[model samples]
Target: MNKNVAIIWGGYSSEIVVSEKSMNGIYSFLDKNRYNVYKVKIDKKGWTAEIEGKEYIVDKNDFSIFFGSAKIEIDFAYITIHGTPGEDGRLQGYFDMLNIPYSSCDWMASALTFNKFVCNNFLKNFGLNVAKSVYLSKDSKYDINAIAEALKFPIFIKPNTGGSSFATTKVKGIDKMQEAIDFAFSEASDVIIESFISGREVTCGCYKTSDHEVVFPITEVITKNEFFDYNAKYMGEVEEITPADLSEEKTLEIQQLTSKIYDLVGAKGIIRADFIISDNTPYLLEVNTTPGMTTTSFIPQQVKAAGLSMTDVLTEIIECEYQKIQKSL
Candidate 1:
């Protein structure tokens, strides 16, 4: 019998609209005969599933079925939400408590990668080159000048745990440093101040299955704006070139680094690592445990370059988790 797959999207995050677009793309490519697919939207009203031309609302607090008389049980949940509840550990924790198998990284990996500061530190201990950064908490003393002195000018200030570059700022000098920190702090309790790495922005994605791990081709991002911020990322303000115009040797090095990161972080399913190639060396920027799945997102572009369709990618992720669960039983 075919498995029941729930593609969850549209969460209470800044990337909610983008999540909707991703869900549409996943739904279009999913093989209907091999699996029963449903789209679940999480909004102010809570989780609601749309299947077989009918809608069923789920309880907001407990996630129990509410609307339809016939209940629905999901064999696996394909998470497509871009930030917050989806990308962070919250939703994954929920599924963990209910013993539900979902695609992407588990709770610890999701939580670790969600916070830029924590993930960078974790990887740094593993011998990876991460940018120098300082973390600021809400209760900490405000020392903008001290931080600037340590990290130097042209620093990147962003919420330590947020995604899609929401409320991220580039402070060119000491004069505008405070404003940037305040802006980032407003969105999150912890803020990360990192020294800027001026180089080509490239991303590499990796897929882990039951048998092996595969790294996709690298993609270079050229943004017209100051950096790949919110607008540049989702609004097509940036140019993405696949098979990143790098020498074959450099490309292989980056792919190897990405594979190492995936193993180091104990990342399962699909994950994307963003990097900055500076001085012929790749510096780890951050990792996306739950990357954007929009048609134009970097992962999809790289997957296409690998000669694999998005459907094939998503199906593999689903089946990998399904097989793992069956083995445990």
Candidate 2:
């Protein structure tokens, strides 16, 4: 019997476009021979399943779709939603209550990694190198000059709970601190300010299969823009080199740290970590529990560089969850 899979995408966030794009690529690569897949879209309007040019409202009660009198039961949920309920543990919690397996970290891991400040601090306490930063909420007031003085110039102000650099700003002086904070707060109530680190920006990805727990090749991100912002990441404004030009020793070190962070965070399906290598030390930026699955995204490119196919990557993710479901029964 073919397992019914719901490739969940679309969310109420600035990254909705990213989610849609990545999900389209994922839908194409999912093994159609062994599984029946449905495109599940969720946004401010409602949850829907668009199949065969006809749209059917999804039954949130069971997360299933109905075609006239027939109901499509989802055996596994491949969550590709990038923000909010998708990345912040809300969707994972819902699936847990329904006893439906998913292809991402558990609720706790999702929640922890979704908040950048908390995740960075947690990893720092674990002896991982992290940049110095300050946390703020919309309800709290901080002296602008004090924040500037603490972090120094050329600081990064970003929403503490969002992704795809929706409201991230770089401030080179005290005059820009408030503007940056407001920009970040517009996206989320909480924001973070971090001292700038001048170094090579890179990222690494990892996933757990039925047998292999692997880390893909590291990629160096060099951007024409100020930093690796939304444009650099999605609009092809940056150059990404796989198998980053580093010594064999440097590559092994980052790879080891990547796998260490993955296991420490209790990530299940696929996780990618961004970092700034300062003088050969990898400082953690953020860990993505729901890394983008689009064909052009970093994970896919890294997979290819590591001599792995997208088919193998996606199958391992889906089948890994399927096996866990079997074990639970």
Candidate 3:
């Protein structure tokens, strides 16, 4: 019997487009012979499941869809929502209450990694290299001069809890700091500002199960813009090099670091960690628990470079989580 699986997407954030792309990619990769897959779109409008061009509302009480006289329940959820309820742990909490198996970190881990400044600082205590940064909340009073002196110029201002580089800015001087900060705050209630680290930008993906651990190859990112912003990420304004041009030792170092971070954060399936290699040290940029899965996204790129099938990787995630749930019961 095939279990019903839901590929959830369409978040309440600017990253909704990215989420939709990921959902499509997963739908193509999942083994139809093994599981009955459905596309579940969760947006501000409502929760809906699209089946054969028809939309059915999902029952919040049980997370199910009624088709005619049949009620289909979701056995597993492959969440691709990039922000808000999905990536920040709100959805995870809801699923947890229903004993639902999901393909991502738990609520605690998701919440921790979603907050850029706090997650980096938390890992810094374990001797990880991260750029110097300042954090601000909606109610906090910030002195522009004090911030400029503390972090210097050529800094990055971005929403502390959002992704897809929406409302992120690279402020080259103090003249643009306030404006950049305001732009970032428009996207999130909190903001994070960090001193710029100039070097090669690379990202590595990793996932672990009770049986084995897999770390995909690194990808070197090149962009003409000031940083890898929204345009470079989705508008095709950048070049990506798989199996990044690095020596064996450096490659091993990054892969090992990625795996270590996975354990440190108690991460679950399919997380990607980005870094900036400066002065021969990899500085932690940010950890993405729910990484993009579009055909051209970094995770899919890395997976292909490793000569592995996305189908098999996703199967491992589903089976592993399912087994864990069964054992707990």
Say which candidate scores most in TM-score. Answer: 3
lDDT per residue for candidate 1 within 1-329, as digits (tens), equals 88878898987766787889888877876888888888998876667887667778875455545545766667888898877788887889898777667987888888889889999999999888899999989888867778888898889999898878887999899888888888988778799999999998899999888787789999999997999988898788989999899999999999998999898888888899999999998999999887887778888899999999988888888888887777776
Q: Which digits, one per residue and each the tens of the lDDT, describe model 2 over residues 144-174?
A: 8887778788999999999998899988988
Question: Order the candidates by lDDT, highest first — what do you get?
Answer: 3, 2, 1
Candidate 1 vs candidate 3, TM-score winner: 3
Q: After superposition, how far is residue 11 of candidate 1 from its true place, in Å?
A: 2.7
lDDT of 1: 0.85
Error of 1 at 183 (Å): 1.6
lDDT score of residue 167 within candidate 2? 95
Top model number, lDDT: 3
TM-score of each: 0.94, 0.98, 0.99
lDDT of 1 at 183: 91
Each model's backbone clash number: 0, 0, 0
lDDT scores in order: 0.85, 0.90, 0.94
